[model samples]
Target: MMQLTTGERQLGAIVLIALAILGIAMAAAGRTDVLGIHGAMVLLYSLALLFLLFSSAFGPEPSPARLTRYYDDPIKVGVGLTLFWAIFGMFIGVWAAAQLAWPILNFDTSWASFGRIRPAHTSGVIFGFGGNALITTSFHVVQRTSRARLADQFSPWFVLFGFNLFCLIAVSGYFLGVTQSKEYAEAEWYADIWLVIVWVTYFVLYVRTLALRKEPHIYVANWYYMAFIIVVAILHIVNNLAVPLSFAHAKSYTIWAGVQDSMVQWWYGHNAVAFFLTAGFLAMLYYYLPKRAERPIFSYRLSILSFWGITFFYMWAGSHHLHYTALPHWVQNLGMTFSVMLLVPSWASAGNALLTLNGAWHKVRDDATLRFIMMAAFFYGLSTFEGSFLAIRPVNSLSHYTDWTVGHVHAGALGWVAMITFGSLYTLVPAIWKRERMYSAALVEVHFWLALVGTLIYVFAMWNSGIIQGLMWRTYSPDNTLVYSFLDTLLAMYPYYIARAFGGLLFLIGAIVAAYNIWMTVRAPSAAQLPLDEDLPASDRPLDGAAPTPAE
Candidate 1:
């Protein structure tokens, strides 16, 4: 069993004392209920820290190791967590989708209300599912490309465990009605504080690992992931600046109010999509595509261009969400212009991904995992183009507060983010578990089609419904009175909602099949393990069977 070192023990004791003080503070402030939720979160973080500290002190001494030893375990743990959470997160997504079709499907429970569950679904997928995937893939890419292990084993575990614990607290608190009510920044003060510590740990670990890298060339994927981690840390802190009523409590009031709050929230919200979702996933694409295809990236120059372009342009596009609002006209115009420019970089990345499959098209057909990734690239292109169009003032006027925005988000989330995550897991599981292959490739193909078709049906139906509702709402009946009653617009949405539910059901079925496949793979007899240092050519691998070049 692991045991804590003197330093580690001191850290644990400090954390406990901090929690106790925070609890007392909240109770004194008459916010005990809020403090209880946050206290639970604090306990979880403390537990994770304790595990790390003990492991560092007393776990079996690591072998005389190269850089790979440090990162490999962390990568495996992170990947395992990603796979575990994918099913749960996607399940929540299907549930939320069903609620749109039948509001009563939420069971009229406060915990399962549309408002609460929607955040739950989003947080589950985005932070839980997506976050795990990003960290796992980023760790893998960083280690392999840099030829270095992570800087420290315990630190990685701390970041992973603590972040997930924070996610748990944030999601659970939402059901309990503890929120700052910021769009993507909804977690109250306690979760925010824990996250700050976890994020700082992550930043430190990454920087330390980079410092020890063997390669002079920092891989493109690491660049994107670094940008994501850095920018998100800043964004989170800025947008979530709130004064807690007490130290232990989850409840807090945003320092900003009214339109200023709205501006800050959306700015953080949209960039969360940009940096967290787009940038991080792009990192995955950069590494996985080349690795899976067993080919050089199509154009390194294009990648550099896209990276800078996206970084510059995406920051300004958030204001487009607030077009025609109280925001200054120049800010809105800047958002519109930058959003249009965003198409260039977005497509550049997509083009790079597709072109990387230049000689690897056969693998895409045979490998269900590769197909999912390829299709994700396709959807990324489609969604970005749609996003650019939606950001236009005229388009925003029509689509705002309607199902169109919903459709757009799902197109990106389900089609792009979830698909890439699935692809990454499919690639990761067999490799990590030392399995020769998946439980059933045919089942994966079925899952792919189900998700693809389901996403299409869901997004397209909502698009049609949203456009119709928007048009009807804007139409005046001879005089200045509204043309359609709110109920009439809702009535118009029923059929589309039903279609969306059907699509969501299909997607859920796909996720269930995937979960079953993973479970069987875990249970099945293990294959002979390969030597860690064995340097097999890409052509020797199942996924990347193309001939290896001298450069490799």
Candidate 2:
């Protein structure tokens, strides 16, 4: 609170008080239901924040010297939260995988059931882990690229913590049976509204920071980050449009019904993969990859082309997820076509990242951090190819609703998204903390191998299980009856499920190792001999006057 001015302190109190009042209102309205419990949670959350605010209010004001440098406290906190969510999300994923292999693992608990925690795992990893990574990395990236501290420090922390609260509400709601049952958009109406408020604040903060930049042009990474923020808000608001049963309840009816709902949901779903998973991470790649490699982008023009290609093509490609369903044949074909076209840009990006390392492959061999990025680019290419191929109607016939789809998504998620993020964090952590290097370079190498082997095992096991399951369903005797029952296919999945759980376990362990390494790095005494390192990327430098003005 002391970091902020007196006016900011008053404004903070007002917001927290309003939130607490709203929570009380929700509790009063939904006293007989789970909604009331969540309302109580909100009350506690707000009051906790309020107390922390006032408790810190007596500290001395921030020095004007801070204005000359970047605002990185939020980024530091963000990195820790990212790893925390990664460990949590991956653990849930392993548990869910085990439940699939052995149903008894659920212990007959409703909250522990696969159906509930499945969304929880997905949301936790994607929005919780991935979202925090994006925010923190972007906060770091935007400052260097723009050559200015954030317009103010308040928005960064607010956006980061606010987004995490939404994630908590979302994942917790799943366990409590409080969802509206939309796939990635599963959070109930109140949570959805809260996210809109948070997201808008993020967008405004980003743009305002950019506006303060000394550079005349926005960096390519910022372009992708901006897309992630803007498109997700659009996708979220549109597909999740719903009329709540009442403010007193968590239940709501989506405005779209039947096939329309399916179409809208999938449209949001696949593109969530595009904008949220792909674009934001690509932003990480655009900035961090070259920095770690110490090479300029191989082709700035190609990067621009890939950016525009992704922005234009990905929106329509979402319909591919609805293949072989009630969606029109034309829509399916269009989706397939666009998805294939998407590979062009996707490969362009992957190739761009790889080609940037043409002279620096030795770094990749010597540095686990660079290898993490290298493998991510390779997987990005692989997953996009698989996705485009899977969208074909004939191919979809075999892969749709099969474990193949699950495998493909993980190929992107575990392989591309998680890999690149870890690589970036490894690079970011040392610089931010003014350390010579990580607490243990060997731990990073350990994580890299574990993540890689785990991803491969998980992806390959699902591939085998999915193909067998798909083939069995289509196989028939001369009598024209099915050759295998659904139970038979279900039974066949157990081995693969076991393999998947093991792979997820490896990934979870890697996350835990990462968290410990980061904590030790943070807590270790700062190295006084090291030079001042903001750890800014070299992709862009600020103009002479880009420094924060005294008034700022």
Candidate 3:
């Protein structure tokens, strides 16, 4: 049997004992109507406990050396989970899109209904997939740049597993008709509390590791990650302020009502995009792009400038989501102005990314991973530009309540977020796994084309559909009367909706191919592991407790 650490043994014993008690309670509760959705949750938790025990009893033995350890195990697990959730989330997204196109795909079941699964799809992709990518990459990048092992071994594991636990609860609750009704903040109060606990631990662990860094200055990537952590905590707690109806029922009501609630929700929503999608991924981009290109960043000062600009500008931009509604006119204008101004920093970073590749365009041609990052940078610039345009009051009037917003989002989500993420993973996976390269670079080329083609199809379809809908809605029939009924708009959307679904399916396929390639890479017979000291340039890998080295 593997020797478990004192913490591991205690944790395992607690879980084992807790599961035994909960299993009995849940078995009784199953016979009662009051247990509700928790009965199912109880069974799941019990099963999880069983798996925990099996692993605790029989998993690999603990290593003896602490300082010499690279802390790659949890990161490796996080990478695998990232791929799994990406497939699961994108698959749900495809299904939800099809329901829009065909309507009959809902099939009259609550779980299958578009209303229920739409949240599932969003949560799966955004929180499940994207969130995991951020956490895992942060773990990997922090150690590499800081050149310190994580502060506590077990705490990192707890952060990863605990966050995933919250994801599971949020996803399951959505399917079970348990929600708080806020867009992107739908997980009920209990899940919200659970997440707060996990997030605080994550924040602490991150700070602790940074404190132990051997280098004098904290790396730029850590700055973005730190901002993401701090700002997200503020947004989550403030926006999710609610009173639960009861502990037994997964239901809650927001503390704020009316316009105040609208303000709060968008504050959380827009920043979720800013911090979650943009900042975290931008941090990942900063680390991965230059590393892959084997060049120094184009301008470190520009990175510093862009980071501050995005951090300051995005906080006020959420109110743009509530424009032309009950939100005050000045607040609406404030959001529009800030959002439009955001284009400067946004393009600055994008241009910075492209310029880093000044001498590496040839590598971009041969290396699909570089191609993914390059395309991601281009799309990041394009999407941020589109976002600024849409934030203008008049443009918002046309794009608001139309599929145009959806197209814009997919452009960022698929184009910027997913594309860069795939690029990073391709760069990181083989290196961490001690492989010369991916199982097949050929498959990577196939995936890049599939993802690019899919994103183009999806974005153009929504763009065309949104403009048509906007034009139809505003068209006057000679006397300032509405020319088209709402059904006419719905009718007009079928072809575009079909195209969107097809595009999503193609993206999903590309993700699966990537996942399979990663699996094969991990399982392939090891070509001797690369020495940690030699894996990166000496400037990039500072020794713990040593002074930093100058970059070439």
Higher-scoring candidate on TM-score, 1 or 3: 3
**TM-scores vs. true structure, each candidate:** 0.89, 0.95, 0.92
Clashes of each: 1, 0, 0
Candidate 2 scores a C-alpha RMSD against the true structure in Å of 7.0
Global lDDT of each candidate: 0.80, 0.89, 0.87
Model 2, position 504, has a per-residue lDDT of 85
lDDT digits (tens) for residues 1-552 of candidate 2: 346766677777888899899889988998977778778988999899899889987777777787888888889989988998999899999999999999999999999999999999999999999999999999999998999898986777679878998999899999998888888888999999999999999999999999999999999999999999999999999988999898898899999999889888988998999999999999999999999999999999999999999999998988888877888989988888999999999999999999999999989898888999999999999999999999888999999889999999999999999999999998899888776677777788899999999999999999999999999899999999999999999999989999999988988888888888788777654447422354545534333342222210
Candidate with the greatest TM-score versus the true structure = 2
Judge candidate 3 at residue 70 and give its lDDT: 63
Output the lDDT of residue 352, model 2.
97
What is the lDDT, from 0 to 100, of the residue 492 in candidate 2?
A: 93
For candidate 3, lDDT tens digit of each residue in 1-552? 133566675675575467457545644544433234554565576567557656666556577774576678778989988998999999999999999998899888888889889999899999999999999999999999999988877677767877887788789877877778899998978678868987999999999999999988888999999999999999999999998765554567889999999999998999999999999999989999999999999999999999999999999999999989999999999999999999999999999999999999999998899999999999999999999999999999999999999999999999999999999999999778877778778889999999999999999999999999999999988888999999999999989999999999999999999998888778664435433456687665534432211111
Model 1 C-alpha lDDT per residue in residues 1-552, reported as the tens digit of each score: 122235545555576557556545545554458566456455555655556555565455444544335346666667667766767776777788778778888897888888887888778778988998898878777877888877765577668877887788788888887777778777887678779999999999888888889999998998999999999998999899999866545567889888888888888998999999999999888888787778889999999999999998998888888988899999899989999999999999999999999899999887778899899999999999999999999989999999999999989988998898788777777766667667777778899999899899989998999999999889888888998999999999999988987887787788778877766665454435434245777544333221111111
- Assess candidate 3 and give its TM-score to the true structure: 0.92
Which candidate should be chosen as best, given lDDT against the real structure?
2
